[model samples]
Target: MAPKEEVWNPSVETVTPVITLSFYFYPTSTTGVVIQREGFAFSYSEEFEQSEWVAYSLSSLDFSNRNFNRPFFIEDPKVKSRSADWRNYKKSGYDKGHLCPAGDRKSSYKAFEETFYTSNISPQLHEFNDGVWNRLEQKVRYWAKKYDGLYVVTGGVLSDNLKSIGEENVAVPNYFYKILMTKDGKKMIGFLVPHEDSEKALYEFVMDVNTIEKMTGIDFFPKLPDAVENKMEKSNDYKEWSF
Candidate 1:
């Protein structure tokens, strides 16, 4: 018989304190399989609550020796704004800025590069991205060391229309989010934090995978039953997550 196709399910778990999140593992054509699900919603402070962006180190995730590349085709025209020009911003000695650092998952250049996907990016000041956000990515790695792994989704909320420099047209985020999961198949946890530089503007509130899909109008883990989604939303205790 042909090899059976592998499947995955969201595994919800609670991290330190009262934080609860969801994540899942899926087969990948190149990497054989990868963790590809995340739970959490990103909304304006006035619209939804926020959370803090913690840092994780590459060493903690055991990816210190791996090579990785940024994701291709990551650009959000909507991320542009009147406050600063892209070209000027680049020349100003600030990188395009990735909320999910490449170093965290440096298994391969492809994996590392995917971190550049516009969907996973935000217009953050160099100091913030390189400093605070970078630290958060490292901290996540530390958590991974103990838990064995984590699947995270993070990004910023675009509240205004800003024009792209070269095109002179308003920019819109092709995807206003970034998701990462672990290859190991134990517990699954995800997070969604804001791109705003202020610590106060980060991860304001938390929600489950279902709530995230509802808020974003996107369908995640389509193979899962409706009851599964429902359960994730209602239960604060993540142990209920199952296939």
Candidate 2:
């Protein structure tokens, strides 16, 4: 389901934290339990034992160029259904791949550390995580820098009877997908990538957001007007984004 738009009046007294402004771009969550964090928000899938999708804004101001020592993955306190354990990936021959990449959160130590939470990870091949996926992430950083900022949503395509790993039987998705758009919702792009390592250029995986929505049953960018949303979601034009 598309996220319901929340109108917050700053003058109104409220005890709860406001949802991040970026939440406007969140996709539909099939498995439910959407968790909000200071740095990002994600819809956790109890059935898959991982986030179905992680949504965050990448801002040019967020790249602080600071390096931090990696931290151990831990269960997300916000997830009502306990997130999968980091140990599940132990000797499982799959890397604990990050959905919201650590590199994107270097603006603060807390933001960087939040990416280590177990709910933010999925199983991935070593080469795939370090190679093609990494490449796509770098390209995103480039776009974020060029365009000032972007709303990004990413996750594996979770489904039934897939090869699973870990004591919790963490599902290893056959494919992963990412969608990005400017804050104004004028430009958009999506990529659906195979699970294994690949030498193919990143653009080769370029897909329209509508196709991905059909494949994953997620309604991306519901806040856009129907005219704009329909047109943007139907495009696979690589020229819109600079490589």
**Winner by TM-score:** 2
> TM-scores of the models, in the given order?
0.49, 0.91
Off by over 4 Å in 1: 1-5, 8-62, 65-94, 113-120, 156-190, 200-205, 233-243
Off by over 4 Å in 2: 1-21
lDDT string for model 2 (54-164, tens) is: 998887666677889999899988888799999999999999999999988887888889999999999999999999999999999899889767788999998878898
Error of 2 at 42 (Å): 0.4
Candidate models: Cα lDDT each: 0.39, 0.85
Task: Report model 2's TM-score to 2 decimal places.
Answer: 0.91
